[model samples]
Target chain A: MTAALAARDLVVGYRRGRRARTVVLDGVSLTLAPGQFACLIGPNGSGKSTLLRTCSGLQPPLHGELLLAGKDLRRLTRLDVARRVAAVLTDRHDTGRLTGRDLVGLGRYPYTGWFGRLEGDDDRVVAGALEAVAATHLAHRVVAELSDGERQRVMIARALAQQPSLLILDEPAAFLDVTARVELVALLRELTREHGLAVVLATHDLELALRSADTVWVLDAEHRLATGLPEDIAAGGALGRAFPTGSWAFDPVEWRFVFCGTVRGVATVAGDSLHATLARRILEREGFVVNPPDVGPGVQLAIEVLEPPHAAPTVIARHAGGVETHRALQPLADLARRVAADARPGETPR
Target chain B: MLTEERVAAHPEPAPRASVDGQAPARGRAALVFPLLGLLLVVVFVLGIAVGSVPIPVVDVVKVLTGHEPHGVYHAIVFDIRLPRSITGVLVGAALGVAGLQLQTLFRNPLADPFVLGVSAGASLGVALVVLAGASSEATFLAGLGGLGDVGIAGAGTLGAAAVMVAVLFAARRVRSTITILVVGLMVSYLVASLVTVLIASADGPRIQQFLAWEAGSFRAITWSQLHVLVPVLLVGLLAAAAGVKQLNALLLGERYAATMGVDVRRTRFVTIGTAALLAGVATAFCGPIGFLGIAIPHLARAALGSSDHRLLVPASMLLGGTVALAADIIAQLPGADFVLPLNAVTALLGAPIVIWVVLSSRNAGTLGA
Candidate 1:
């Protein structure tokens, strides 16, 4: 099947004047197939938004060809592009006294008559779009009265009402809280599968993108676009390098960036997966250099997490001085403090 | 996740309706438009009846329907009051709708043709003609009855269109609404100073005529003048009606409107053009009437509780006509011998309403929202 959207050797930029130009991203190529959920992740000013705008045909590409379902973007009228690709930008418009349904109805602009009168079929489509986003109840409520998350959902419904083949959003989850962000991304993922839409969203949400997206487009500082499966990108270290972790390292296993601190002392953690990872996190936070089980010579300290089914796990810590065991994790903090004191004599452990 | 499944399973109980009962509020809001229409009819008749002559309502109706009432009463009702009242309604409706369009286009609550210097431009055009010895030609044209009104209306329309074009040019350069607003205010001051200079250089009788015109009244619109005013106002209104969808789309901001397939530049041009014509024609006939354009849209929104242009455009027309008639009635003062300046009466009525709307919308925190 042909891709829903394709950019070939695209160079996006703005012309400054008669002769001068500012290039944002150059020599970029990507394709989005139907039913695929792709996320564009990059740091600030890395041209992610510019690329999304270019792909949506909101701005003309300075160089190269953009195709929408194998049709040249340049040949298509704005209405033609609008019919096939819907976009939700980050601009917050104050639609005074407009109901949610009215806003969502605007998505049908290209399909409606000259005066934009909504037929019965158009109303049904708008309702369906609202239903898809679980915002049917908000249909009659004033759009300005809605919360940020609710408004975002309404905007998504508006995009969906267009019934486009591809949907592009720029920082849709920027203003949402953690749970709202997760729910929004999950909702987009579900819509992509159910509606067979090629959904591309530019987001600062790395963790959500890594966890939920089918494919990830990582734009690095050098203007290189790397496309791969989310897991492949994470495993290949492209995602990490694209984001550039300064004080932290991407933990592929945890699917998050973990803080990397200076090594205070060496220790070995031995336990099941859950408890071992938790212990490692706690020790690492305290500046202890934790090693994988049986991987390194951790001469000073050894910690064992004992997990018995249906009971609280017990932590046992061994040091040069003695062995300390506790039923609760709070005791592990105390043990870490003691170890720190022992490691550096006459130094207070805070 | 499970939340999605739960929502799908229990679709009957939509969650938002529980917080706010949307249906009843919407139903109550629906009654406001008809109520405003009824109020307009009452004010329209009152405007025709309660003029300087104090014709009884029955006699006013008789003369309006071509009954041979007393000859003097017939002349007052048919010749004097009817034309003035009609002019009031048309001018009111024109300014009201123009104000609404200006507000939406600029996304500024304080936007209006008068405030944006379009009306001032119209005044400057009339001043140029009346004070610059073109008065003899204008008077000669006035002798030709309706033809004179058309010439003045033409001049006013051209002037207003010129200012609108300048504003549109400035709008392209300035991204901030507040900056554009300040620019419009500067334009108004510039035009006002020029008009002042023209007045200072004019003779006494010309200054008196200009002052009366500046004072603003519907009395100037003779029956013959309506021929020019009505068609111009209607064309402007039709243009505005045709662009209702674009106007509503524009409420979402220009980029989103474009994404919705609206040609932003063309819509802007058409909208500003329509507003200028309406305001300029009204100014030409009524001598730069103020307050109705700025105040009436807010009143309409406050009544209907929606910015949906489909309803707002008509609601504004009715409410604007009503307010203008009411202002004219107060200016005439019916039974009293002395008539207040139409401009002063409108300012008195409009300034309070505008201040009230500003304070209330501000308190409600819906100004920008």
Candidate 2:
């Protein structure tokens, strides 16, 4: 099967005035096959949007050949490209009085002749696109009234209404909540499998994008794009270089970046029991660098989880200032919070 | 009802509607057109009947039908009221379509033909003839005949077309719609200041004539002007009607419109040209008619409860024509000797609606503020 979209050493950028060209990305080559979900990840100003725009025919490539469905990109008219590729931009526009159905109906522009009158077939295609995106119920709701998640679903349905072989989106879930983000990614994954669509989405949601993507294209800070399977890319640790460690570190085992808070101070948890283990976990989570019991009371903040005769775990924090008592380990997590806030240096614990 | 299990991929083998199957009369758009058409006729006739002399509706109809020959009523209906009232309809409809196109093209709801400085450009064109040419030497104003209806109207068109070309050039260089709007407004201000300077150059009688023209009136339009007005306005309206697809895609903004195969640049050029032609021609005859171009599209959107241009374009035309005639009657202040300025009536009636739009926005986000 032919690749849905292929770019050979393409250069993407904008032309200033008569001669100056502002190059955003250069020497980029990639091929995306039908039925594959590819996510392009890069930091801001890394040229992800430019690449997506060039691929979807929204912008002319500065150099090199681009082929969409085996046709030279330059050879195709806007309508011809519309018939093959659909794009959803991140820009939020005023929908005003348009119903969800009205918005989705606009997607049939390439096929709808003059006047853009929706025929019966066009209506059904609209309904089917809505159904596929699970937005059938929102068909009559005015787009202005939709929540971000719901509006996004409607927008995706609009693109699907185009019935394109390839779909490109720039930050489609930029404004969605976590649940909505998951649902959107799941929907895109299903679309690739169910419709054989070559889908490419550029996004900041790294974990969500990587979770279900069949292919990953990682662009580093310097505009070097590397493409591979999600597992291979994660294991090879190219993501580390692309998005260098800052306040967060990437966990190789979990294949996701884990956010680390500022360590307030060292805390020694004195117990080998399950309760002690739970206490240590909470301390580390609250930005406490935990020390082993062998490091002893010199650590300044020492927490002991004594096995209680009662059901709850008895916890005690002996600091340089004083000793504090807690009936349970759960609330003991708040001790880290209070100390992190007011206990700068060897201050008294409240 | 074929599922993926039954027919392979869901996108394949869609249940295509047969040729006989067609779109249902969508609820609002269906009712809006004919109802607005009826209202248009009613207001237009009321316009003829409600003027100072108050020819009874029966006589107005009789004169319209040519049942009465060579009477005062005949002269009034055929020569005066008919031209004025029809000019009301023409000016209103032209501004309505032009205004609707501007609002969509800018994505700014407040945008109107005036914002483009088309009217100011026409004012400059008119001032060049009326002010500088009104002197005893006065050769340019009477290049055809003493700044008569045709000469002024022709100058207005020339001026507006010049601004239209300027705006189109500015649009090509500017990428954002917001920037284009600013460019158009600045150009408008620049042209308007030029017109003011010209006003200072003229003497008394010429200044009075220029002031009367600036006041904006439909009554000055004669049947002779209609011959020029109708065809020019028709081309603009036709251009608007043909741009339904382009306008609809444009609602999402230029980038999305481009990806969907709309020639975004061409759409911008055509939209600006059509808008300029409509407002330019109408202003040529009517002399700076205001509010209708901005207000009428909002009225149509409210009436139809839709932003779809097919519905908006026609609804605005009809509603605009009806409202213009109504405003004309009010400006005449039926049964009174003194007439009010058309601009006063249009602004008095339409400004509130714009205020309502501003207050009703849930936040500035919806207005692109």
Candidate 3:
């Protein structure tokens, strides 16, 4: 089958006049096969929304060809695109007295004739959409009264009711808590597989996207769009370039960003995972970089501990001047703070 | 984290729509239309029978059925009461629909033709011809006194159209409808000042004529005038009907509606145009009736408990007509010789309902802070 969505050298941005356009992303080409879940990542003001809007036909691209299910997007009317591509936008709305079922029913508008009365089949489609999102229990609830996660599900159901081949969402998980975001991404992924749809979502949940999305779309600091496997994109340092920061470091192995504090000392931690992790966190927070325990034992501060994940065991800190034992990481961190203030890392305390 | 599990088939769609609950709300909402329609008829009959002259209900029915009624009953029913009652239904239905559209279009509970300056625009049009027509005009234009009711109404429409154009222009340039609301208020103030200037320049005797119209009444509609009035009202209602789908989509706001294939600008244009037609034409004929336009839609929603425009359009029409008819009866005060101003009577009937809606629905999403 043809690619579910393809953009050829697409340039997206705002039009200042007839001849001048402020392009945000230029010469970008990307494709997603059916049943692929792609995440679009970029910094704020990086034109992710503009690009999504352009791809979904809500806005005209500054230049380029966008194809939806092998048809040129520019040639299709809104109704045609709406039939093929449904989007969940970021606009907050007050849906007064509209039940979840009723809100989902609105998704059938592209098929509903002028009067817009939902027929038997349309009703079934609405019901199916709600089921797909696992929101059947919420179907009778007033959409306005639902919690954030529930309402976002209903909004996604509204889009699904259109029965589009490709789904585009702009920040669908914006207000959701961590668990809700995970559940929502999983649901979208399942829908893509079960229904054979191509899904593109723009989100700020970087770890979740990297872990779950089959394809990754990254807009680098230069605003150039790159598409690759999530692993490839993460390993290639594109994520780092896109999300430039002063002190936070992306730990590729653990698949998370760890805050690296200013280093005033060098330290080594030798312990089980539980003690070592906490001990290292304390050292890092106290402006010391924690290295492995292999550096010559007496050369710098070194900590050794033995503790279960839950049990509190004593940690011994040894230095050139003296050795101190602490019951917990907090006091140890305080001591390290004082030691660093007294003398720099790799130097004996004055 | 994304994980691959053994493939399973899709969950089965629900066998039927959720029906165990919501039946009561649905049933009640379904019953409201016919009940309001029945109320409309009762009040229409009351509006006719309980005017300055207390023609008995029997004679009111007899005259309506084309039977000969005794002792000036026929003239009262045909020449005065019937026209007034018809005007009530048309004007009420028009204002109600227009108000519903305005509120939904701007997403403001307080938005109405009167609040948005459309009525003031129409009033300014009438004021120009009635108060200042003779003072300045090409002899190509005759005196205001000679510009029949139709000409005054035409003037009213021109004013409403002008203000509507400005409001639409602002809707395009301004992101927030609340800003448009404030601009509308200022525009009304400007129109009020102009009306004051016209009143200041007008001769003393003509002030009574102007005030009578300004006070608003259904009594001035003539049989010949209904020929002009009915068609215009019908056109307005039809425009509103054509826009029901777009308005429903708009309840989700413009961006979602656009993604759903709605032409947001065109929808806005049609909606504002419909509001202008109904409010302008009604104001042209009825002279700036207030409260009914704004209050009736909220009442419709409360009664039906749904914001779907399909239901709201008709519900507001019936409820508006009924309330306007009832208000007219109260204004006449039955046997009393002194008649209250129709605008005041409507305000008295409408203001509390509006206040209650705004207050009660403060957190109900419709009027959330």
Candidate 4:
């Protein structure tokens, strides 16, 4: 089967003045199948948005060819393209006091007659679109009165009403809260699988993209487009290569990237104690999931937790003073502290 | 039925489908409204013909059927009442269609030709002609003189053109619909102030004529003027008819319109220019008749149960013309000899309908506080 959308060696740009122009994408190529949900991810100014716009035919490519359903984009009329591709842009415009149902029904304009009289099928399409996006209850509510998440869902519903084979969204999750974003991603996943819609969305939420998308299109600083499986891109350190200077690094173990400095406080505790357990738990909750052991002079954890919600047991000692605390192992110290604490405790602590 | 089953992925199609097919069965559905409008036209014509002089309905029919009637009867039907009634129809349809287009284009129920400053432009144009020495008598004679000299009507068209240009420019520069409306109001205010200054500075006779013209009258329109107006109004109505599809596309935003294969920029150009031409020409000749444009579309929508302009435009034109003719008959009815400014008569009907629309909006009612 032919790809629903394909762009070959495309360059995209916008005119700044009568003559001057700024180019955002250069020689990029990509293809999306009917049932694939693809995500375009990059740092700001990396031109992911520009590429998506070009592919959707909202913005013309400065060079190269775009094909939709086996027809060249340039050869297709505006109305013909509209019947095939749909989009949900980032900017929200208030169309006065229109109902959500009215807004969605507008998506059927291309198919409706000159008078825009709603035939039976038009109403059915609009209703199904509303149901698909879970915005049926909001059908009668004025569009301007909807919440951001609700409004976003309404926009999706409107796009669905077009009954286009391909749907492109620009940051559909941008205004949504965490839970809404997750639900929206899951919704996109389900929509692709059920309807076989070729979906392309641009978002900064990398975790969601990694979790949901069938393919990831990464835009490098040089404007090169790279398309592959999410895991392959993560493994290649393309994110670090794309964004070089930040505190960004690929965490091979977790299969993701983190963008923060490495934490630096060390503690040593007695073997078989609770403080070591409590310290590890606190650090993990704080996004510091890595714990590496050292051969020379680091702390060793030996701890246990009691009943529910109670602090665990641990041992800690200072090397110079040979100080050791028992019954309540507060903080952990280095290897030298364990030797000194062993002398202080005199209990042959492991 | 097979096609129906194939398209059944859509929910809730059955009710709408039945509604679409059963329009004829519904009480006072689309056909009834148009037929009623035709009946009103007939009644209005007879109302205009039968007067204090009490011309027989048969004489009125004979006079309208273009046969030679008795001396005074012919003079009354053709010379006096016919011109007035036709003028009412022309102005009413023009204002009504213009109003509907404006309201739909702005997506605001309150939008009308007068509120959008088109009428102000016409008023300014008329004020310039009268205060500038082409008085109403001069205007009437100019009509008699083969429309050679520039007068109130011509000035009105020029004024409307200026307003249309300003509003269109603002629409291009400012993307927000509300901002465009505020700009239109501001432009109208400035033009009104200029008209006021002209009135204050005018000499006595010119001031009296200007004031009278502002009151708005249909009696001044002669048969010769109707010849010019009928063709212009027809052309404008035809132009608006071509734009029904474009207007439907515009019910959504320009972006969506463009996405749906509508040439947004081109639609805006054609829709605004043609609507402005219709409104401006009608206002110029008819002395800025009020309310028909704003209210007639609503009445048509109520009658037809649809907002699609293909039906709404023709419905509005016919309905508005009928209402205007009826209103003219009522304006002439109170006394045998006396007459009223057509604007006052129209406002009595137009204002309440507008208020009803604003009040009917559940949101606007709450926001009114």
Candidate 5:
């Protein structure tokens, strides 16, 4: 089957003058298949939006060919391109007096005749698109009256109404709250799976992207594009380098980037599952270097997570002086801080 | 959230029974257009009947239906009132639709035909002809009978088109609608100063002619002039109607409109061109009539409660006609022999509505939504 969208050695950039071109991202070759949800993650100005615009045919690629549904993007008519690839941008419009359903009905432009009368089937398609986004209740509400999340869903529904095989969005979660962000990504994922859509969204919400996206497209600081499954990308370490920070590291096991501060001291964390993960997170956040489970030797301080049957999870810290047990992480953290402050240099107590 | 779960369970056909509730609002909105149409008819009749001569509605009807009302009633009803009322309807519709297009194109509530300097450009065109044409050689140039009227109309269209092109060019560079509005104001100021200069240098009778034209009136459009004005207005209105799809797409910003397969640049050009034609032709026949161009679109939107151009365009036309005829009726000062300036009547009726729309939209946060 033909890929929904493919780019070959695509170099995206802006032309400043007749002979001057500033390249943003180069040598980007990627394919998104139907029923796949991909996310583009990068730091600010890492060319995520430039890449999206190039792929959506809003701007021409500086070099290389972009294909939509196995046909050259340059060869497709504007209407044909619109029919194949629909994009939802982040522009806040003051659509005076337009209802949500009316906004979504605009997506029928590519199919409707010159007068843009919504035929019976067009109305059905618009309703289905609204339904797909779970925004049926908002259809009658004025677009300006809707909250940011509701408006975003209506925009996505507008794109969906195009009945395009490929959908692109720029920063779909930029203004949404945590729950709305999660719901939006979840809705996109559902649409991709149910409708065989190739969905590509550029988002700064790394956790949402890592958890929900089927394929991750990581654009690193050096302008390199890496594409793979979320797990594969996390394991391959490109996710870390994409958002390069000395304080944060990609935790492949958790499939999220966690703040791994400088090595304050090596402390062994002992336990399993959720408790162990929570304890490690607290320790790491407090500037303690956590030792792996199997590597037990040469660790002066140790902490264990204990889940009692009828109480809150407990944390037990074993140090050179003695062992301290606490029901909460804050007190345990305080204990670790005191130990780090007390232990003298070159004093290895076993 | 429950909707999400239900949608996930049955993705094929999510029930849309909730959409049925909007049917009543839609039905109510559907009634607005026809009501506006009826309002236009009533106002048009009022414009014809309530003139300087107190012709009763019965006599006005008789004269309109070709029954000869003996004496000056025939001349007043057919020659003067009929053409003037029709001109009011056409001019009002043209300015109203033009204002709607300008407002949507700039995405600014403050945008209108006069606000954008198109009317000022038209005024400048007429000023140049009326003021500078006082020279003997220029008088020979203006002595070409009907060609002189065409010349003024052509010059007015060219001037409006010129300002429209400049504004469109500036709009390409500026993203903020407020900045574009300021640019339009500056253009209007510059044109006003130029008209002032022309008035200062011209002779006494010429200055009087220019001043009377500047005051604006619907009385000057003879049947011969209406021949030119009506067809131009119709063509401009037709162009605007055909562009309903593009205008609707533009409710979302330019980028989304482009993604929806609307050629943004072409749509911008055509829309401004049509708006210019409408405002210019109206300014050519009547003077630079104000208020209707800026206020009618808002009235249409408020009445219909939708920005759907399919409804708003026609609604604006009918409402614009009604408002214009009503203003013309007041300008005639029906009970007395004195006349009022048409521009004064329009501003008196329109400025309050403009202020209300601005304050309400600002309070609703719909200005930046």
Candidate 6:
């Protein structure tokens, strides 16, 4: 399938003064495959929103060519773009006491003639769009009375009513609560799969993007564009470099970063199947670590509570001196608590 | 948020369009109503029959048909009432069309000939001539007297045109609606101050004459006056009719109209120019007849159940004529020997409708969703 939107060496910015300018995107080129759910991630002022606006034709790029399907974006008339690329911006308009349905009907303007006539097919498209966003029931309510999430959904419904081939949403989940955020991500995924729409969304929630999006478009701090599968990008440490330098690290074990070096000597835990093999390896590496359970008294492992296969196990160590003889536990929570206790004075790990 | 979503789901179809979203059909249907033609017929007949010396309708018809009746009815029907009533019809239609165009152009319902300062400008022109006792025919030439003895009508036209020019210039520079309205009001005050200075300096006779004109009587209109007004009024009406399509497209706001390939700036200039001509000329001859222009368009929109100018433009013209003619009849109340000022009768009908519209829709900011 042809790329729905392609940018070639795009540079986007605005002039600050006669001689000064701030560049949002510098020589960035990328193509979005048809029907793919692409998520763009970047820190503040990293040009994510600017790139989206340039692609949607709302803003002009300072340098570069953008093509929608096979046609160059600059050559296509605004009306032509309206029919091809539908956009849902973050700006909420108070369109003077209009109803949800009234706002959606405005989406039909591109399809209508000079007198703004709407035919049967136009009405159907409007209805179908509302239905797709599952906001059919809210159609009768006034826009001013809706909650934030409801308003966002209505905005999406309005964009859908445009019936464009490509959908561009900027910060779709910005105002949504945590649960709504998750649901919105899932809904976007389902919509892309069902309609085969080339979806380009800008979001700050990296976890949700990693879980839901097929491809990730990273706008690094250096004003460069990078694209790859989410897994490959995460594994290649692209996210680590792209994000601003901070007191955080990519926790390889957890598959996402956490604020490391903030806590002191944090205890790590493993699942039942991985624990025994890990323990054996640790023993070979450090010779004094292995003390078989119920053995004689220099340092004894008195309790080796082993549950059935697939069940969790726990280990406790007893020492004559003030030392933790490597207290091993099957559950990570218990290990964390014991390690936290060991960090206190009087008890030290050998 | 869900409310907006819900509201967005059922976007209000632009007013007057059918389910298919086609241009309103009522406009085409309204053309056959022939209301103006009918009103002309009634007012002409009534003008002769209902005067101080009552001529029978049959006698009036006979005199108009040139049967050469011996009685005073012949002189009254053919020479006096016919011209006055025809003048009223044209002037009324002109002001109505102008008011509708101004309101639509500004997207302001309260917009009217006088409020936008066009009428004030026209009055200022007339005041300068009449108050100064200047018989400059070029400045105030369209009247019953020969070109040398210019009357209030001619001066009024020049003043209105002057105001139109000023307001149009201001409108071109400013995009904000409230600022434009404020500018129009300030211009009105400037013109009013000039009129005041002229009135203060005039002798008692000139001042009395100016006061009479300010009272806004239609009794001064004559056959000679009709010659100057009929053609101008007709041109103004035709210009407004041609503007309906563009006006309807403008209902979507300027940016949206531009995207739809409308040259918004050009359309605005044309519509405002035509509106200025209509108001200027009407105020020149008939003396700032109030209320009909502003009230009639809203009444037409409400009656037609649509804002599509195809129906609204003509509907407003007829309605304006009807109201103006009706006001003229009330001005000539049988019991009162002296006729009331035309504005008195118009305000009676116009004010109530405006108040009711405001009351019915608590928020005039948006049509009831």
Predicted complex 3: CAPRI docking category:
acceptable
- Model 3 chain A weakest 10-residue run by lDDT: A341-350
The Cα RMSD in angstroms, rounded to one decimal, for candidate 2 relative to the true structure is 4.7
Docking quality level of the chain pair in candidate 5? acceptable
Model 1 CA lDDT for position B73: 82
True lDDT of residue A109, candidate 3: 82
Candidate 2's residue-wise lDDT over A146-234, tens digit each?
A: 99999999998899888887999899888888899888889998889877888998989888767889999999889889899988888
Give the alpha carbon lDDT tens digit for every residue of A178-264 in model 1: 988888888899888877788998998888888888899999887778999988988896876687765578888888877564455
Show pairs that collide, candidate 1.
none
Query: Model 1 chain B — which ten-residue stretch has the worst lDDT?
Result: B1-10
What lDDT does the true structure give each of the candidates? 0.79, 0.82, 0.82, 0.71, 0.81, 0.67
The TM-score of candidate 6 is 0.63
Model 4 Cα lDDT, one tens digit per residue, B27-119: 435565669677666966666675567677777877778776566688877777778777777777878888888777776777887766777
Query: Comparing 4 and 6 by DockQ, which wins?
Result: 4
Distance from true location, Cα of B369 in model 6, Å: 12
**Which of the CAPRI classes, incorrect, acceptable, medium or high, describes model 1?**
acceptable
Per-residue lDDT for B91-120 in model 6, tens only?
777777887787776766778867668888
TM-score of each: 0.86, 0.89, 0.93, 0.75, 0.89, 0.63
- Candidate topping TM-score: 3
Residue pairs that clash (backbone atoms under 3 angstroms), model 5? none
Evaluate model 1 with DockQ and give the value. Answer: 0.26
Every model's Cα RMSD, please?
5.3, 4.7, 3.6, 7.6, 4.4, 10.2
TM-score of A-chain in each prediction?
Answer: 0.89, 0.82, 0.92, 0.80, 0.89, 0.76
Candidate 6 chain A least-lDDT 10 residues = A261-270
Alpha-carbon runs more than 4 Å astray in model 2: A258-350, B1-25, B69-72, B136-138, B142-145, B334-336, B363-369
Compared with the true structure, what per-residue lDDT tens digits does model 5 show for residues A1-350?
Answer: 89999999988998876889999988889999988999999988788998998888888889998999899988998888888899988898788777788889999888899889887677677777887888988888888889999999999999988888899999978788998888888888898877888999999888788888899999988888889988888889787778777767777897666766445566888777577787777776765667754555646578888887777898888988898888777887687677656644332221
- Candidate 1, residues B1-369, lDDT tens digits: the string is 112333344445444543343454456557876788788878877888886557677766677777866656887777887888888888899999999998898887778877667888887876766666544655643333233545556666666777878977876666455566788789999999999998988888767766777888888678787887888889998898888888888887887887777777777767777887788778866788888888888887777777778778988898888888898899877456788888898899889987886786744225532
Query: What proportion of the true contacts does each candidate reproduce?
Result: 0.37, 0.50, 0.45, 0.28, 0.49, 0.05
Give one digit per residue, the lDDT tens place, for model 5 in B175-201.
455676788889999998998998899
